[model samples]
Target: MLKDIVDVLADPVDGTPLRCADDLSRLVSESGHSYDVARQGYVTLAGGRGLNHEGDSAEMVTARELFLSQGHFAPFVEAVTERVAEVIDKSHAPEPVVLEVGAGTGYYLSHTLDSIDGSRGVGMDISVPAAKLLAKAHPRVGAVVADAWEGLPLLDASVDALTVIFAPRNPAEFARVLRDDAEAVILLADQGHLDELREPLGILGVKSGKLERMMRQAEGYLELVGDAELLEFPIRLDRASIAAQVGMSPSARHVEAGVLRERLARLPEFMDVTARAQLVRMRKS
Candidate 1:
């Protein structure tokens, strides 16, 4: 379905419209820039110098797929999907486009699409492994490989609803891509998220004032639309689930594989852990 979002796509190097060419095997831009569509069904739209950082590794992406599939983050996903549905309904834009930044595995994006009728998703991520999963995550999703921190590979004011869950954000780029009436739904881990597993597993803990800092960062580019919503829930996680949670997070990079395995084995057979996060909606200023 790369053709589904062709109109919204712009040349990463020059922000020009792109068209499916060579019988849809390539994307040719008006400025003479061309990008090839991978046989796996995704495309990389980085600029001349390429991406500055790799978003997630194959192992991290795989772990994320496994963890998310178990539905531990169901509340978080539901909140995001409901917010997206509300946005799409209020916009009255018949053919809506939803963009998910750092859309790893496309779990949240695919869910949002299912909730909103006739909506398409742009699953943008920098990792090839993530893109591979994103390509097939849903029938209506168009996966693109690009850095989230840099400028997004999209046309100005082309997106209807944007979602970012524990992902990087570029306020200026977000403002540029979102329409004036469009909204951005953001979910950030709050203080005490996964606190139960931190000490026992020696994993990283959530920092305080994350939402406050994020609002401060979005000063000029975006403004808060409604009151921030807080969601906190407890999940019973087995040892395998615990490992998957840690493996898909920044803590994975901090701990050595063997040492981390040993630490996981020391935990109980099953433990109750809190999954806490805050959801906020913003509009382009």
Candidate 2:
């Protein structure tokens, strides 16, 4: 899978082109920098200092896989795949490359790749655990452990479409890597998402003005291609699904495990909760 996207990768230190080494187990840069491919099949593309923060832990990644596999976020995944298909159809690139930043477990990336023909993906996340799962999530995807805050380790204008779902975005770097007509499809969680669980679970709520702040940040480098579309749906979740949802989110980090369990025990067997997010399309300015 790494072989599919090897030509698009760049050296994290100096931005030199990269190639597979003699045996193809390592990636070597034009400037002679070497990065070993992990036995699990992913590569870490951080610079000399290495990553500052671990994006997600193995527990979190496992919880995410469990929660998503249940299809609780089917609407979100469908919207992402639909938008990517539209972007690819418009571009008409014979073999389009889709890069997903902060791609947790490669769920969305794999789904999009399945929907489009002749499409490959780069699943970039800072978490090594997440990268390990992403590496094997699909046959057409290449997983890389890299920070979203840092510039993406990709060649200039190399991507036909980029996707960021419930993750960080670097608009300037996205603009540089995306082709002229390519778009960055972002799915941002809005207020009222998980409102039913917030009070009982004692977790944080979505802050107001989050989307507006994101648009302001992307003003110069990326422009909003269209109005943001809100995708809201309700799901009947059991206690286990509720636990997995909380455990995979930032809320998991704030609350103590025992306390969360105690609270979850008091809830009904099934709950009707809203999953809300905004899908926005942006293009290079």
Question: Each model's RMSD to truth, in Å?
Answer: 0.8, 0.7
Deviation (Å) of 144 in candidate 1: 0.3
Regions of candidate 1 where Cα sits further than 4 Å from its true position: none
Model 2 per-residue lDDT tens digits across residues 144-212? 999989889999999999999999999999999999999999999999988999998899898877789
| Model 2: number of backbone collisions | 0
| Shift in Å, residue 170, candidate 2 | 0.5
What is the C-alpha local distance difference test score of each model? 0.93, 0.94
TM-score versus the correct structure, for each prediction: 0.99, 0.99
Positional deviation of 233 in candidate 2, in angstroms?
A: 0.6
Candidate 2 regions exceeding 4 Å error are none
